[model samples]
Target: MIRRILISCGIAFVTLVANAAPDDSIKVVKGQVSDYYITVTHERIVKGRVLDKNHQPLEGATVMFFASPMHSTTARDGSFAIKGADNDIHLYVYYPGKKIVNKILALDENNLDIVMEDEAHKATAVRRPAQATRWYDPQAPLSRTFCNPVNISYNFEPFNNNVRPNGSFRSSADPMAVEYKGEYFLFSTNQGGFHYSKNLVDWEFVPASFQRKPTDDDQCAPAAYVSGDTLFYTGSTYEGLAVWYSTHPKTGRFKRAIEKNVLPSWDPCLFLDDDGRLYLYYGSSNEYPLKAVELDRNDFYPVSKIHDVMMLRPEEHGWERFGMNNDDEVTLRPFTEGAYMTKHNGKYYFQYGAPGTEFKVYADGVYVSDSPLGPFTYQKHNPMSYKPGGYVQGSGHGGTFCDVKGNYWHVSTCMLSLKYKFERRIGLYPVAFDGDGVMYSSSAFGDYPNWAEPMDIKKPADRFTGWMLLSYQKPVEVSSIDSIYTAANLTDESMRTYWAARSGNPGEWAQVDLGAVKTVRAIQLNFYDHKATQHNRAMDIYHQYRVYASEDGKSWTLVVDKSDSDKDCPHDYIELSEPLRTRYLKYENVHMPTGHVAMSGFRVFGNGDGDAPQTVKGLTVKRDKKDRRSAFISWQPDTDAYGYNIYYGIAPDKMYNAITVLGQTEYDFRGLDADTEYYFTIEALNENGRSPLCKTLKY
Candidate 1:
């Protein structure tokens, strides 16, 4: 009699027929089986040595076989060995600061030697498959300080519309950051992927598309929430959306938790209460108020009826009016969106962005309540995060997240709407809640260098590195300039304008005179996309340039060199390893990703030899009786000052809101709570430092 038996091991199964045999041994399998197949197969030990182009053994190199989990790291002698089935296999070799090597080799071919080329020799070496370049070198030491416009590569707009016939400029906005398992993940609109960081300073991009459904947009104003060990994510959609969940986001592996949401939401935010209840807040419109609803944690479906949260009150909230500077209420209505929630000390804070993102006055406002979905009361100090006057403006439509050290940070959208209304960037600021329970985000010196890990959490200003701008309004000379784009635009402190070279060619340069020798600490090179035609995210595009410093106009010393860099940094900020004293700085272009070489700002930051600007003598504050939210403040301008900072709050001791005004003595203070009494102060700033704040005045 013949009998059939099936044996399963792990993922492979084998079917066998038991025919009477003298030995009674298993016969050959009919289906594919695992390595534990009854038949004996020979395994060979594959050995290899990895070396650089110079024939020097590259220690710490990683060697692995493609399509196999087996990997080994080279020892001090750059030799690695792995035992595998005797067959031809694809091998991959990787080393820091070197290009990856991939080759097909026979497992029996032992003592194999592989040569890798340095990134600097990429142009001359044979082209291989493109690999994703990390934002920072993994072998280099982690950075302690970082500058804003946050530094990661922004993605080009993916679609072509009437606004952009070709492709749109690079843009990212409506940011949301969350801390999961000691690492932070950042998500922004239209950036085909997200970025994760162990130290917020060194970020690695993870390519992922959460839009499993048929939709034109990807993750627009995505909502991210961490619960237990898993992180749930979804994007703004008018139709049913999928909620993706990932335990290991670093690997970019996410599975859909909810295939289709029961309700549709735009600009959504997910909040999980301490008691384990989940809620969602969403809205992005000028005609409607933000809405909220309780959700079932298991199924991620709404359990309670939608509740009307809050709407734009432009008549009483000056900052809510729609305009470039909150001054266009007559023609345009304000937009209320970007809903976020943070529960602290038993009170729930509902934060939302107001006005318009296309304007410099884009800011975030907050309301306090005792319940997740309730009648929330407006916070007296409105626009909790505002940076209307800075190198990069707009501090709205973002999420607040806490780091591992319990420090709170607000990552918001910074406007760069010159190319399209959606063109934008992201900025991070220190957030704190005082003893009185008033929450605020510090934007003073917002665009300057700030500490990634602050020294003190109580003092929000401690985040600033005390690096003053030394290149603002300084004299500049360029090799060639287009008639429409003047050289003066380089130091004009505006992202909307730029100085373009006659051509995007090598050796084109721009030199800036600091007027006097000053101690230089950091430099920020803001490159502009002047006539760029890229419509999609181009990973291979990069920028290469060199910066030099000079004490005298003639003798120059190399300061920052990136001639062979394969990474793209449109808004590149470099902190020198050591401080240098120089009065003149020059930026020489080696390569441009596309279009003419253009720069919005070549900002230098450090201390000046001279004293700080003097405090203002004449100060005035006039509150509008018709609309209590409006006020007019002016101070006597300091002759030696390049800018001024206006500080105001509900009380003298609670002065947290600051607005950095450049080359202006008067400001139309229009963001205030109608019933709150306020105090105001002003201080002058120059290349050296800031003056002592003027005496606090009550209004």
Candidate 2:
């Protein structure tokens, strides 16, 4: 007789067949069998091939499992075999400059073939449906609005071999934007080139360097000026460096204007006056005052002796004190550099960056004079450009210029200083002169989304888009995490902290759950360089990723697809073509240039479903008796608010200066004129919106 029995061994089911054996040793206890064999099955290998649109084999393409760590690269014949779980699996195929292909198949399946299309060519060929709500349009004109930390491809440090032997982070500081022949040209320090744009929205990099002299160093804090049809450029150096000029800067063609500069200066500014005269203003030291000298319009040589213009008086101006918050005075002295001169209404406004570039308090102050070289007097409303608090900080070491619409704008350096002390970015703000001729750049929501083109500037907050942040302190989830770099860092509202995945491989992702279904309009992905290896500018380096949205976390719909993007965007901001009403947003990593998949901020902005925070109460302002230039401002904290914006000025209508303090209820306002009686007010802000402005109080 033959008999068969099924027995449970622990959690496994096993079958036993016996031929009428008299002695069968099978011990069973509590439905568990002792004699049993557990057969383990290994993962199966999935094979695939990647081909181009023309059926040509594409090599070096990456094939990765969506939720598994197993991955493979295509061989010369475009064939790949990756091991994965025996069940159904999701796979992603990625090739540079080609459209990404995603597939869902069983691991037992074989001979998977994916045909990729050219991303650039396909983008141009695809057209949006006439009646559809479009989220993005490559061919359509961009909106007039823009945000701070201008979105350009910031290059890695090219010549810092001594301090950065392995590699440094993306940085560009000391910016100068000038309009030349109806186009705007941007020049900054250590970029290895410059960028030009027809409208400031889109910038095209032009690789060109100055003709260096024997005694000069590379460009650090460059200066550019447009005279007639030619745009002149030079760098900061104690030893004279040659000046270059270019009529067609878009072509990256430049010729030496002067073989060697006549005067040796650092942080130089080449200013061309309305009267056909030229002057150079330069200074970059804590001890020395800014100096100016007339340059001959003919040969670009000094025509007059250098004269001292202005110096830093930390004792008098509280904003000039050196430290992270202008609170240090025992050891460090403030350094004043970046001398920029703007002539308006027959009055010369000399602007300079102060304190320190690495500090959040880094700002630009103005001094007024009747002549280019002055016995200058400090402006009553000083620090013409100040941005002490925001997502990106600092507004120092920059130049100001007028746009095509005759609207004044200031382009300045923003602080990053994470990888290295000089690691930074650039920002642009709308500037205006009051009826009294006092010049001030509107920086009140400085880093928030604002109109990129000219708009009504009657009020300081007129340029703000009113899109409140929706990702602050939100819940987040991730595919993988490091020991320390957890997912919580994503919504901390800080650039210094980041969420770093365990690997840089494809399929790693982070998902954020906005507390409720919010009307999402924009997303800003700020990538952090964690364990990056590249030391210099790499033109081919880029990031590829995909974003998805869903009301429920399980069912996701594609929103932003950049899997084939060729451009490098360290701080990538995307404004959706149509608003997405979803509670969850997911970011899937396709490729990283040099490091692990790390992100400092996965910021989401739009309207909330709830009400704005209530107006703050118990507002108080105490002017320092010993130092009238500084004041202590505080208010009762709101339970629903995440931060406060303190607005103050000499008059209630003129509350032009605003300090954004996040996660705080108090601020030490120090950038004040001693004799000015200021009016102060505070506004509460949260993910929903900003509260109504509190009652103004005179101090």
Candidate 3:
């Protein structure tokens, strides 16, 4: 006999199983059973994972068992489970705005995997109803600044719904960012254009003024560096990878000189050492090591033999291996590209991005050498730039620069692309050098909007200010919404899906209810460019909106007013000068870049749950003889922690030195004296406060 059970969200169900032992991981419980050989509930169960077409886990997906009301959600790993009461049970996997996935299990089947198709894959004429679940895009279209791809003329999809793999909204890979005259500028290989940001928070698209004819090769991975007052640029091929220069970066035009062969290069950058010497670093591909050669001072061309700095070694480094989990074993070797170098405190730090441009784990790693041309050693904490879990993903192929405040910041690629393997977006992270001279980029809340000011102090203990997520899955109301483009999407936390007004008319608004009154610290009004047509910077004023907060659902008060603000911030983050308490929040749209009144997140961040993180524990330190300059430190992470601080030195009592590892539990101690006895401890920090130090360790 088979029994069918049903349960909904937050509901519980009990099932009988004559299992050898109950599995608590999925809440498999047992009930009355027969004796030994005649156990009434003979062990039988079905469990598996829900994945997208790309084989990536679909977290937070809702799974329902057919006929049996019992079901479990897909975990971060995408696994779901249900009691197997019969030989045939249909399982349905659903994500908001995505196509529904169904699978059936027959007898003798213990594992069933389901892959969900994106509604985008289906034609608009045959689309399903809106399930406004996710807050971000799935493919992660890499088109922030110059979404336009170079070879856009040769595409299959003339009309793509996602707009990511399509024209203008295409790949903008290798965001070579630099600070020039107090403004941040990004050049990429995708569109052969550039982007400029006055505050590192709002990037505006600018056309490639230098290249009149948009030849795909000329714009690929353009390199720029300030030589005295002139900015030198090169990359992509034309007769000889010609050198271009312009005193004004924002002007977007470069004066191209018809010089000759500067050594066939890929992913290249010109680095100026403090001593007035010029060196060139370039190469990208598993076939070649990231090589460096000295550039002549007079003409800025390669003057010496190239030195192979480093190569891809996925066989040893798991992070450099390709695949969603970096465990896929196949024919082709991994890729190593995006070479960048920075000199700090007389030490040369060479950074490289790797493992192909398509992987989620794609990141930037580092190597250290005393000389510009080096026998460089890989830093134990490789992939120094990483943020795989954020709304936007990859952080590889980026540029490191010092802000006007003398603080270090890394601007790397984020978001994603599907039309092309290199489809990507740009992201900024707070970075710092420790007492040991090791450098790290803090990715805590990386995709979240942050302060535009350069932090001159040591990198923040926590990149995120411990702001609790106050409106996740909360009740939402919109003045007007398009069919299926519901209001609840305003607080889903992913940027892929959003709430859209019935039309792009002024006055359309979306509001969120936080359930109860709560203290709000700041609000991130992330507007979306939903299938927007104008790819280039427009003549119209920057996107505009106004925010209001209320104690009850009725009366409202102005909390943040940007109705007249002139800034092109699709991901706009507005920090209130002070914290305010309110149960209801609303956003009124004044105007937008395009016809849709779309919004990804009307996020409310504040201290709703009052409490600091618990103290860190399980501290461990390891010293390896292979590399004498670094120590690897790790500890159990605190769920509530905004970040972790690792303190260490030559003596336990005198361990005054420290480094704050943001959004991660493990940290590599670089610049340490390998032979000296070193002691270390750790502490967890949140917006409220810090926890006590954990047990110390010596090496």
Candidate 4:
């Protein structure tokens, strides 16, 4: 028998208080495990705090799951606790007009700090999906950082020395970024709202203007399209085709375009052709082939039946084949989803994400159709947006939009499925058309803190962040540890192993010694809740830690002090306004939310020696004899190099594009404008910085 469980989630930033005050209005049995969930091998207590966007505690919030009978509520501190079954559960949180949260709770998981935004606090506006009321200004520098799976808090407080911990954390997928009114707005499934920004780097979350709030599945793979003056929105729903429209997304209101389902749509996209026609593309699972249908011009509803548009062929398209390098046999058919359409210079470009969203290689593959609705042909240069080797992966299921600088950017999803199966992040990458009119995504130096093209000031031809490891394999010291967990785990560069203090109390701490004075740029402190059980029910717990640096172990200078901080940061990072020179960095725990001070990454990013990398050797650039548009480039390995960069352009001085490969010595350049002579240069990069460009080669 299926049972429904009730529980709430929130990240409270309120005055410190216990959730001990019980509300007589509702009855809840705390720590009471039930058999409603199957395979109940173990039952654990779940605890967390809920807060509003303003960092205030949300009182009397309700949290529940659709599958279990257990339920919970927030007390005065906007905190809740309930017994969790062995199975994973999705908890739904509701506050006044705030966008609701559908957070996941695994059997062994607890301690959630959820944040909600209050809708009443903002100036709200109503809009239709087909009208656009705003535009972006091109006079400003675009926000440069565009790494996938980045924490939103990371963008708000950019990578700097004075940056604070992430007060809010979220996982969103199926990105749809739209440009309007001199600004860009980003929408994602389960985000409750959309985010807007003048520069792409710094984003502000605003409630979506939807006539009807989305249900669970409806939020999975939503789609958006732009017409003359309207921005149309819809989502995956077998129940019905619920469409929304908004001219001003920043104001957080959308009117219903269609309330009924004319066609069964999932993982959908609404495409409007240049000839004033419209179409819808969808089909999210591997089990089904992708299909399209034409929409009526008047109501924007499906006019006729759905047409079978395309199907997956793993044998032909290796990138579309399941698993990394297309090797998975267990799941024979790869999941073909995230259908998108972009008309570039009269050619219809059809893009879809494949392999699987959860995998590191999750990416987009493109097909070209002469007509908006037609038989499409696959592009030889498949996997339109891919980044397998980076701190973050999975650049798929995202829409492309033009920025104020007229540069095209694809905002895509990043994968971090550990916390939950669908746990994700988002990123943006630059796109350009080669001389052959071939579309290409620039990810060579992707995810790094690279400059954002001409919109951002022109830096070195290679756009690397110049950030190198300062903490990997470094010596670590902790206050005390349990048997298995050790201080060494902190710098082992593995998320699987973590350092767990014997007790999580004020004054407990850990320190990392670089062994010598090194210029430090950033510190990322990742916290892990491993079977943690040391918090009062329904109350907020925040980061009250102190960070200090010292040239020597004894003499310390305060670098980051959160002793009086009210922010909750499970995955915290800090950047100094200016680089700090120190041999030792200490992370002192003033207070912890769970039973012990558990940490996975006490990472540090900076320069060592403040020097450039060794020059690459034996640089060879040979144009593909068979394919003039393609080039084969290779270089000799530099022992101290963390990665290599390949720069190429049609003109000698205009080497506009680059590719950064880590631990690899060779890269094939496909999708180059056919019949164009190219100039090529290479460089090596380490923690310190990139070396000078190698001798240029003409192909």
lDDT winner between 1 and 3, please give it: 1
Q: In model 4, which runs have C-alpha deviations exceeding 4 angstroms?
A: 1-148, 153-170, 207-218, 226-230, 247-251, 273-276, 304-309, 452-454, 457-463, 479-510, 522-546, 560-576, 588-600, 615-638, 642-684, 691-699
**What is the C-alpha local distance difference test score of each model?**
0.83, 0.81, 0.66, 0.67
TM-score of each candidate structure, all chains considered together: 0.79, 0.79, 0.64, 0.64
lDDT of 4 at 160: 22
Estimate the lDDT of model 4: 0.67
Error of 2 at 187 (Å): 0.8
Lowest-sum lDDT 10-residue window in model 1: 129-138
Q: Model 3 over residues 530-638: C-alpha lDDT tens digits?
A: 5555543234536666677789878987765555555555656555555687899888887676758887677777766457778788888877668554567788978
Least well predicted 10-residue stretch by lDDT in candidate 2:
124-133
Better candidate number, 1 or 3, judged by TM-score: 1
lDDT by residue for model 1 (295-323), tens? 99888889999999999988878889888
Candidate 4 per-residue lDDT, tens place, 1-699, comes to 212233334321223223533321222222453222222135667788889887788888887776777778899988898776556477888888988888776655678888987665455334222211111112231244332334343211112221122222235788877777777777777655666777765566665533243223225577777776788777787778668788876677888877765677878888878787888888887888788888896776778677676777765454566775455757567898888888889888888888788776688777887877768887655567776554556688888777777777787877756544465667677776655656667665565554443354322224456666677678998898977889998986554468988888777899999968988876778776544532211125566677888897999877776665544455564545567888999999877765578887787777888567777888997766775645677889898786776777656655654555666798765434454566888888776777888888887
Q: Please report the TM-score between candidate 3 and the true structure.
A: 0.64
Error of 2 at 284 (Å): 0.3
* Residue 103, model 2: Cα distance from true site in angstroms: 31
After the best TM-score superposition of candidate 2, give how far the Cα of residue 566 lies from its true spot, in angstroms: 1.0
- Report each candidate's C-alpha RMSD, comma-separated, in the order given: 14.8, 17.3, 20.7, 15.5
- How many Å off is the CA of 235 in candidate 3? 3.5
